[model samples]
Target: MYSQLWCRTGLLGLLWLISAGFMSAQTPARTELTVTAMHPAADSPLRLGANFSLRIHYDSPAAFRLRIQGERQGTTIPGITHASPRYGPGAGEAIAWLAFDHLAQLDRILLVAEDAATGHVLTSLALPLTLTWSADAPPGAPAPVWVQELNQHAQLAITREMQAPADGGDDFWVNLFLQAVFLTVPGYIILQIALPWWTRDRWRKAAWAPLIVTVPMFLFVVFASTAGGSNLAPIWLLLVCPPACFYLVFLALFFWLKQKRA
Candidate 1:
């Protein structure tokens, strides 16, 4: 019986060590993303006229490609003239231009992207192709009325409205997180204190008390000082100083009590 118990204890210890290591490794780590482009607009379904340009934006740095597949009905056409690469972590843009001497016909097109290092396809977005231009009036017919002035003015007005704000969602989220952290820590600290008193587990009660009370309060102060207000930082920091110092006193008290009991 003694030998059997010893063997079981050894196996349990090994299992616990493995479990602890796994839990530690599971902590969050940063990740890097690769972005690339796959297809060009010339091969798109719209079969745009030779006079056109395609612009693409990527969220990360990686090898990009633009594939044009189609035929031109008109005389000799000018092929792709220039290619450029942009770099950034969150966003980047690419511009490709196509020019032709005379009007041309086109068929289908595709776009694709892949990781430069691993050669893995990351993202692909197909764009609709379109081309429209006026043909010469019939021999006897009069020219159609064109409204270039009003259209140009309206386009400029609309472009300004579209570029107003990047995104409002992030501001709301940061505010919400700050509020939750504010409310949660105080309650958690209170519960920690109540349980230890109720159960008479001095060590556990003491061990969790300082963390439960201090960590949340510290995070709340950070969020409030940084995200809460405008530029009145010096005053806010001064106002928050007393409460933080008081919390530290409580932490010391708990530690002293725990040590005495132990």
Candidate 2:
């Protein structure tokens, strides 16, 4: 009788241990939250004082909430400008229209996701951004007309007036004309005068080269000027002058080389 009782006790203890082990094996692992995509892209330019869209795609097994925080000089900028479906579970996307009302200088933006139930941080992402005027506007200027038009159609209300008149002004016409003249004059000079006069038969084959190389940049400047604003004089100098000078030097080198060989 004593042996049977001891055997029965051992059997019960073994069964308890087996059940505990099974329970431990059945428990689910904690799911890690991950961000998969963002819009306007990382390291892309953002026009200051404009309403821009930010979209984030993420995956999570548990319920989560997302928040965007913009900081300049370590201080938070307030105003819940825009966002959609801020909280949910599993894999999903969130979008927001953010305005930089107070962005006098460049600001750092943080996208933070947290566990909804426990209020613990799940994941955080940093967006490398530059809050500047579009390649056309002057530094520290308000958002441009095209940008403002974009905002008027968006969820946010942008209040800045369009600086350029609808009828277009003398300054606008003068700038446009100068841009065209600048692009055309250089090409004409290189193709008609400089290349023919300077380079020989063998090197002349590459005469169209300078115009071909610089035309794309010229077109880009024209497009930027039209869409961004009429004030692209500074940008024109930065884009056109250095490359033009370099191309001239390259042509000179080629001429010298060909002449030396001849």
Best by TM-score: 2
Clashing pairs in 2: none
Q: Encode model 1's per-residue lDDT on 1-262: one tens digit a residue.
A: 9999999999999999999999988853322222233222223322223324444555644444333222334322344433323223355454344433344444322344544444344565444444321233122222112223322333554465345334567766876765655554454455555544544455445545455445655566677768975333333333344454445446557766876798
Per-model C-alpha lDDT, please? 0.45, 0.57
User: Which candidate number has the best lDDT?
Assistant: 2
- Summed backbone clashes in each candidate are 8, 0
In candidate 1, position 111 carries an lDDT of 42
Off by over 4 Å in 1: 1-50, 61-78, 86-89, 114-122, 132-262
Give the poorly placed runs of model 2, Cα more than 4 Å off: 1-49, 84-86, 133-262
Taking all chains together, the TM-score of candidate 2 against the true structure is 0.35
Worst 10 residues of 2 by lDDT: 154-163
